[model samples]
Target: MLVIEHIPAAIADEILVGKERDTVVMTAEERRWGRRRLRSSAGRAVALALATGTTLAPGAIIAVEPTWYLQVEAAAEPVLAVRPRRCGWFRSGRCRARSSCASWRH
Candidate 1:
């Protein structure tokens, strides 16, 4: 009942023409079954987050099938290198230190 296109010609020909494999219809059936599984998995994920937390922020993931809940987190990705702080008295206008100091002129 489902018509899928945009497949590479070789794969499409093989799947539809029954030229290379005997279980062509089986492939499509498997894909449909997988989608149902994903939905169930995603629901379970949401339930887990809710049961564990008093305050819950819900989020979901849509892979090939819209079935999976991923815990969405916001985090700052810090750069690995130590960057020189930008100020008037340091090389390249970068001063490294926590306290405010008088400007050095060389």
Candidate 2:
């Protein structure tokens, strides 16, 4: 198992041009956790011990080995799409659609 304590800064595109890449798939909820164990596409175990409030974004590199790198990938999940008919009302906090507006207030 590989333990990663900190996430590296964004890697340059030129440095990753020829490297083999693998991804550690995570759900939206999983990405919010600062510490967890995940498995890469290649079945490698990765343990994260990140600092509080650290969130991993899609394509964020986790590890860079000699010839390969591991990154984070957000798994596709169903999401509710809500489009307000009046953008002005929604922005001003005076949306007339009480039912729809109340649902999101919590």
Best by TM-score: 2
Clashing pairs in model 2?
A: none
Candidate 2, 1-106: lDDT as tens digits: 9898988787888888889998999988899998988889999898999999998888799888778889989899999998655544577667666665654532
lDDT tens digits, residue span 17-104, model 1: 3222111211222333322222132233111212221222222121111221122222234456863454455665444452453443
My TM-score estimates for the predictions, one after another, are 0.16, 0.75
What's the number of clashes in each of the models? 0, 0
Segments in model 2 whose C-alpha atoms lie over 4 Å from true places = 85-106
Error of 2 at 52 (Å): 0.9
Error of 2 at 28 (Å): 1.1
TM-score, cand. 1 vs. native: 0.16
